[model samples]
Target: MVDKSARTPAETKDAGVLIVGLGRFGSSMALTLDRLGQDVLAVERSPGLVAHYSDRFPIVEADASNPEALEQLGAREFSVAVVGVGTSLEASVLITGNLVDMGTPQIWAKAISAEHGRILQRIGAHHVVFPEADAGNRVAHLVSGKLLDYIEVEDGFTIVKMRPPRETQGFTIEQTKVRERYGVTIIGVKSPGQEFVYAEPTTRISSNDLIVVSGHSELLERFAARP
Candidate 1:
């Protein structure tokens, strides 16, 4: 519902989301939200970058580090704002502060380092994501050849997909005792042909089956490490 035509702070209208910076993280977030049918307004400082994505979404070319620049874009009306200036800690912190001052309901920021993330949080960023770190962790799991998928649902818990360990193959779901032993739950099974089935206590796990389970990440790692 944001008035894309307004390029000055004098205009006021409501918007669902505001994205600052159009790097990989920013552009990806905007596109994904747009794909999910959300209204998104993106801003980038580079004219060339703005031109490239101009046809894809509504974008404004401006320095997001400046509070007046964002205010002119009606940033205060957006419910959520994401600051994605990964390479510039100053820009990220400044933009996050601007959004916070504007009273945006939620503000997410991208950080390239631990210190950068802590600073953003200290300055009122609601969430800080480390894309490189997260991607590296996933790659490490997949490289091990046992893990197929990993989704971190919370700080300590995750939903993981992996090939059953040698000792777990041929064991019934109940026999594995994942819940009792590891505080995990076997959500489902993916058979050889890529068929998925809701797992029950009597479900027999085959060597070729991929198990989908959810539990504390440490326990899941322990389960996967078993022979």
Candidate 2:
């Protein structure tokens, strides 16, 4: 077991994240949080994985599915915990339940299926994410060829990056009246060989310009589908 007190007072105060498992999802989450300057403690059962990432972040070899192991590592003190062991449903559920029993203020668990997600919610996971499913949905939208990139901010709302439609080519944003006509707002525009610029009334659209627009999902899809 690794010493939890190895972190200094300042690091401990900011290190409220406890992540279990070192699979793809867990590693990605740790890397992103680290990049954002968030302190993280990762627990994994695989010695190889622990060794691989030990230099990158603080990681210990332990099985989080065992509640005793979690307590030994001071899991209760963490304000946030993530159960990223989705390969085994039993292990995932057990870890989530342990976090809940420990009164973790925020518990995020990964679910492979709808049934798994419902189970996690029933057991008190504060948040459940279906990374594979969400990624598939996003890719489906991109494969349509209309949207260069898509982000669904919430139900029925989305922000998309797409090529300017032919009708808007060579026309100023104010003159095109895209907002008035499509009920979507162009947030920014990126012309080739230049940085992205915030959209303005006087900003003109070019045939090759890429635009970022935000609106209801259906409206944005219709706008992007323009000929």
Candidate 3:
């Protein structure tokens, strides 16, 4: 393991995150966390991956499936750890179990399928992510030609960007009564050449305007599907 620097135990415990595996999912997480200014220590079993990212991140070539390797690298110092090994279910489970045994406060594991997610949760993973599955679902929603973008904030709630329907165009928000009729809230609007602005009760919608709306997933889908 490569020691980046000397840090107090409290600082390490409070701020750092340990990320195991450097495949597509793991690498993406590391890059995003780094961009967000979070302190990250990455571990990958492949020497090539470790070398490719070492100059950009604090990474080490280590098999995190082995508890001993994690112990030697002081994995317990991290308050949160992410197991991004999706290719091998066995390796993924082993790493997650190791982190749980070490009493990591928050564990996020990637799951390739529903069963894999269940096992991770049963083994004490605090959060289970299905990146590929979620991406596919999002794309499926976008392909309908109405919703430009869709994000499910939770089980039922969603926020979407879409073109204003004909009924909404050429009318102010208050005039359209969209919220009253459609059960969705227009949070913002973007004109053809202007920056996105917060939606107001009197904000007028044009045929070319883009709107951001938030509501239950079903309601948002219905609103977007409107002509």
Clash totals in order: 1, 0, 0
TM-score to native of every candidate shown: 0.88, 0.89, 0.92
- Residue-wise C-alpha lDDT for candidate 1, range 66-176, written one tens digit per residue: 898887677877888889899988888889998998888899999999999999999999999999988898788778857789988778788899988876689999998
Model 1 segments beyond 4 Å from truth? Answer: 1-15, 193-195
Tens digit per residue, CA lDDT, model 2, 92-200: 9999999999898999999999999999999999999999998998899999868999988877689999999999999999999999999999999999999999999
Tell me which residue pairs clash in candidate 2.
none
**Sequence-dependent TM-score of model 1:** 0.88
Once superposed on the true structure, which residue ranges of model 2 sit more than 4 Å away at CA? 3-11
TM-score of 3: 0.92
lDDT of each: 0.84, 0.89, 0.90
What tens digits encode model 3's per-residue C-alpha lDDT throughout 1-227?
55354233455666778899999999999999988998988888897888888877788678899999888777889999999999999999999999999999999999999999999999999999999999998999999669999898888899999999999999999999998999999999999889999999999999999999999999988888888
lDDT of 3: 0.90
- The residue-level lDDT of candidate 3 at 106 comes to 96
